[model samples]
Target chain A: MTTTLSLEQEVARLIVEALHLETAPEDIDPEAPLFGDGLGLDSIDALEIALAVSKRYGFQLRSDDERNHRIFASLRALAAHIETHRTA
Target chain B: MPAEPAFPLTARAPGEVLFRRGAEPVTTARFLAEAAGLAARLPAEGPVLNVCADRYLALLGFAAALMRGQVTLLSADRTPQRLAEIAARHGARCALSDTPASLPLPVIAPAAEAGPEAPNPAIPAARIAAIGFTSGSTGEPQPHAKPWGALVAGARAAAARFAVAPGTSIVGTIPAQHMYGFETTLMLPLHGGGAGHAGPVFYPSDIEAALAAVPAPRLLVTTPLQMRALLGTGIALPPLIGVISATAPLDAALAAEAEAAWGAPVREIYGATEAGSIASRHTTREEGWEPYPGVAFTIGEEGASVTVPGLPAPVPLADRLEWCGQGRFRLAGRLTDMVKLAGKRASIAGLTRILTAIEGVEDGVFLAPPDLDRNPRARLAAAVVAPGMDAKAVLAALRERVEPAFLPRPVVMLDALPRDAVGKISRAAIAALAWKR
Candidate 1:
């Protein structure tokens, strides 16, 4: 059977592709945040990549989402949120 | 006036080439040679259209045409249709184009090749150089004619503010056809103290490369969106004496981010479609901009209004502002950029920022339809990327931060927004998006 990737692996792939980030997916740590100190993604990039995720993954993130902190916490968390939802 | 500033005096003599992307740096004699070439080629009486891809060349063409006593029509949008329209409007018989691959429009190339040559060319000031088009934020782009003397005066005022010196390399990433870019990169090099890169730079990486290619004490003239994108890239940039950002609002947060990321203060210029440029802000420390020296102004004007040279027509600014001493004022958001909700009011710009701040929201924008004027409530629509989240959830969050009335109703989720050439969301586009209900 074809192997299914973990949430972390999937999210890492998404980040690399969405941002054109010059890094290998495996290089991304599951514990690191996607913005600020971790990946240093700015607000604009956040919006751009978020849109990408919505179109490709069929999931939307709302502004002022109380869970924003956790949702953006790390690759693991984002992957988890996506795995739990993702329509497209 | 003051003995016309002599050209080809490279403080960094024999060092760098005059133009980079697609222009030639020639001695004063060379600039005139190219001008003379065009003059010889043209039928002395008709207006000339300048489609020089290289911004520097366009400036030179403008000057050369003026000296040869020809009227120059400058159009920023060089699409075939627009070019044809401009050519017809001005009865231009020929055009100067840097792009060899461009259409056959009797295009002429500059005689000077791109490079560094030791030659001082004396150019007479006071010639009527060229015409420039406004950004068309308010409506259709209007043309503003400038005399050589006027351009020189404007550049002198700008140079004094920037404090650039001879041989100080200034690189531009913005299209030179625009007034702000023309003044900073082309005119500044000719009449003021610095040397400018030969071409227009458009990309973030190009901006970085331009900064490195130009020697120390360099200046970068760019728009706010480009500035934001450059910062987002998180690339290392060379030491910039200053970064000139215009063509849009330089929000305090964005400016602070730029300063923090680049370790250089981003100086903002207040300019528009009508006026070339009149005031500038060195730091966010002072709320408003200090006017370019020798320019004066007051607040209110209805129509047929006149203000200082290099300033927009004397229309009451769309936004309120706090004035500093003469020629300086802090811009509050535009008055028209605001909207009212049920017993509450907020700036659309503010809502856009809040929406953009959402996690996993790529390229989200809040927009209100023009028909909302019939019932100007806080009714809003938005194109968003938060795929998993529904419109109700989006509204719920907006309510938490902003007033409930200001919460967007009937949020329209779309794949993307229609941003224009400069990444600006036009009112028409917004209204069009709001077409359905």
Candidate 2:
């Protein structure tokens, strides 16, 4: 039987590929923080992820949106948002 | 008595656009009225630290302080420690910012109140206007004070050099606190009778959006780091007359590519926090610098120093240069940036240039091993962010460009270099990276 990757795994792979993370995709904890002390990612990284997600899922991540802090809280959170709103 | 010019420096026709906030255009009359209202409300006692992230708010705070005769303190670092230091220096507990809670000081938000606009205060040319904090690339951030007259003169010179005309609008990707952004984005518009986009754009798409929002002919003021990111995105920007870059070394290849992509020539401004804007060069056309009109440079065995009309003393620059007379010069390298290895010499700046110029290298920096004082013969090290490229391959590429002795001993691959908000890779950060290896 073929196995499909979970949303968390898929998003982790995307993050690693997009940001050129030294850590392996499976090594990234799903609930770990993605900003500040977590991954040491910055505003520029966030924008890159937003652009990549928009291209892959056909949904724009607006900077001024109130839920930005919540959506970008963790990889799991971001993946869940994409799962709900992704058009493509 | 000498005749005093207009206090605010900029007074355009009421309908003339002064700035664009998002998609909305603000007229000169409205901006002046708002600035006058805010100036009336500013505290007259202490130096005001302007930390507003919003470009429009920052500009308003700056103008308000100038009109109030309070010196504006420009710091690129928004850390609480820096804010506390600035507040303690001014002997005040409060600061002026749009986001009050972000700073350590007791925040006094500038005026948004409805009232009669006050007349522009008569500000003297020699009055100390603002203090700029250095980028801390070498050591601790040092304070450089600038008077109103010096700032205005520098702005006029930059406007002429960049060929910024009355209808030109600027969209800057740099921090407002830095000298380059302060000159090109804020002072140029106020003194040169041009409009500026009030958006602090970072992302490529956002920069494209910001550029499209402003009317041409537009000028994109950016740093090398931001320009690289913008170029990578392959987004189409609006029609531009020219692009001005500063705050870091812009590679010639990148300059040519940018010029080709945007259909506008790329000009680089060369100056420091102490001297403000002094010279310009078309990066693709020349390796030498053309000093601003009325500006002269004195190069000696010590280093290069510049003298401008408004400054009281000649400010020594950190770079070594070979003066090619007739108001032009070629930069040899940074004065203190030379590294000696195996009885051979190379500049850290030159090594960094070769590293970043390598194809597929996104961002990179070189550092003399942190224990250099203990062991003067310590080899160079680097932190690079080139995906799909191994350390050995990167070293191989470096070997082709520089002497083998100057090559990095261990090239640590990272996702990104730790650059500050103004795109300056601090020496401390570099030392930490090298020590990690």
Chain A structural similarity (TM-score) per candidate? 0.81, 0.86
Candidate 2 per-residue lDDT over residues B70-159, each given as its tens digit:
888887655566567666766553577665356655687875443465554556777888888753332234678888888888888887
Question: Over the stretch B204-244, how does candidate 1's per-residue lDDT look in tens digits?
Answer: 55566667776777778876666665665555789887788
lDDT per residue (tens digit) for residues A1-88 in model 2: 0112487788888888876555678977778777543554544466568767767776656534232467778888888888888898
lDDT of 2: 0.74
User: Compared with the real two-chain complex, what DockQ does model 1 have?
Assistant: 0.04
Docking outcome class, model 2: incorrect
Instruction: At residue B119, give the lDDT of candidate 1.
Output: 40
- Local error of candidate 1 at B186, Å? 0.8
Clashing pairs in 2: none
Predicted model with the maximum TM-score: 2
